[model samples]
Target: MSSRKFSIVSGFFLQDDQVHATPATIGALPPRFGLVDDSPECWSKFKSRIAELNDNASSGTTYKVFFLGRHGQGWHNVAEAKYGTRAWDDYYSKLYGDSEMTWGPDPLLTALGVQQAETARTAWLKEIPNGMPTPQRCFASPLHRALSTWQITFASDESFPQVMRKVMILENLREEHGVHTCDMRDSRSLIERNFPPPTYGFELGFTEEDAVWQADVRETKDHIKGRAQSVLDRIFDDTEETYISITAHGGIINGILAAVGRPSYSLPTGGVLPLVIRGDDV
Candidate 1:
């Protein structure tokens, strides 16, 4: 495996066992901050702390803040919930869908999913003015649910910060490849038609057809982590954005957390995780 370029800087946030609780949210962070001594728990202070980390970073080292959001509930989630994980994984996940709903080749958000995205929108709208460092860059997985969540959570409302409205679609940001039909993305042409450019751009050299997925294969956890590492390498190498937002799947998010040396916390649908990461030369 290629050398890692980033590691999580803990103690600044409540990212330990506290985040592992059911229905946990980013707001669960402690009010008294350590990033800046005696600083109050507010967005402005958080932004200032990030700036300080960057300004003081040593040569060949850089610090960035990433807001990783998991896409809201999809039909696949519903199916899994209905069937239970073992059955879904062993039998149902490979199929196009159940009799009631379609989840194959990319499933869109369910009603609950849309509402979950709206909740995220409300949270961002409420926080941005409170000194939330607006994400300098935004990215999303190409799957329909993630794309839709990105749109609804950032661009649907005109009142949101303009910077949050646009996002680049990264294939590497997608869920673990193959086996499960829900993890299989649709054609690039269809994705473009649904999420057009200016608002949604593709990574350079992105193929028109789904390339990584295989109907008979399921990517192992280690492979997913490697893919996540490659995507992070791309981002850190190609851009200097200090604050970034990525909308993706639970598996992808897990891989990202792992790549950055964070604990294996299960982010719920529409859940957001913020990481203060320090990147350095290997």
Candidate 2:
């Protein structure tokens, strides 16, 4: 086999476990990251061909993504009520009653919520073709609810290797013109003030509210979107065929999808959304 002996600009020598290169080496190296001189036909031709392959793959390759999930049920759901106006709190108290409004640090899934997660898992498993590349990466929000969902879905499956990453909280997923928070149990006026005109639900509405909860309650949509996008960018940058699985809050998923120009899709407690990121996008 014929081999070219051109120097790399900067690269890891796995045998030595160290990085190497100088300005001189960089100047003589192939243009772009992770390139090596294994072929000598015009570099431009190789690059162009690779670009074409990437576009074709992105458009045609069906990426398999499994969304492990966490229900939004948490203690904060009730604590936020106390901060609302007395009238609002009274209305909420009547609605939910004293059924232990908030969950503890590691809350158990509600009956209906558990069903949601299981349904999501079953649906994803059915969609993925057998013997496809196992999930290349798995990420989850730091919250227990989300973590638990991930554990339940992939903990026993050897196919998916899992890792946890901090992501923007859910409250930041709203449209710029929408409200930030609302008393899910009460206060029609507060709901109107905090949420968008087309509400999601009436029984436990205010899934999109941002009242006077806390200064830190609000995360800039732009910032959160950037962080989520960065996660995707890094994954795509690293490999030509990386399949990423992110187990995160609904909002974080929505933010990342939005950044990629997809319509906002809600991630149920254990829903999965598979995305194929083309190498060219990196």
Give the winner by TM-score: 1
Cα RMSD of all models vs. native, in order, equals 3.1, 18.9
lDDT of 2: 0.40
Name model 2 segments beyond 4 Å from true: 1-99, 103-108, 124-133, 157-217, 238-241, 279-282
Candidate 1 whole-model C-alpha lDDT, 0 to 1: 0.81
User: Lowest-scoring 10 consecutive residues by lDDT in candidate 1?
Assistant: 28-37
RMSD, candidate 2, Å: 18.9
Q: Which candidate has the highest lDDT of all?
A: 1
lDDT of 1 at 68: 85
- Model 2, 1-282: lDDT tens digits are 111111111221111112342323432111321134334443354335434644565432322222324344344334444546465434442333336554333234455555555565554454333322344455544334554455555553443433222122232222221122222222335433433233111223334333423322345567657665565554444434434555556566666655655455543344444443332221
Off by over 4 Å in 1: 1-3, 16-41
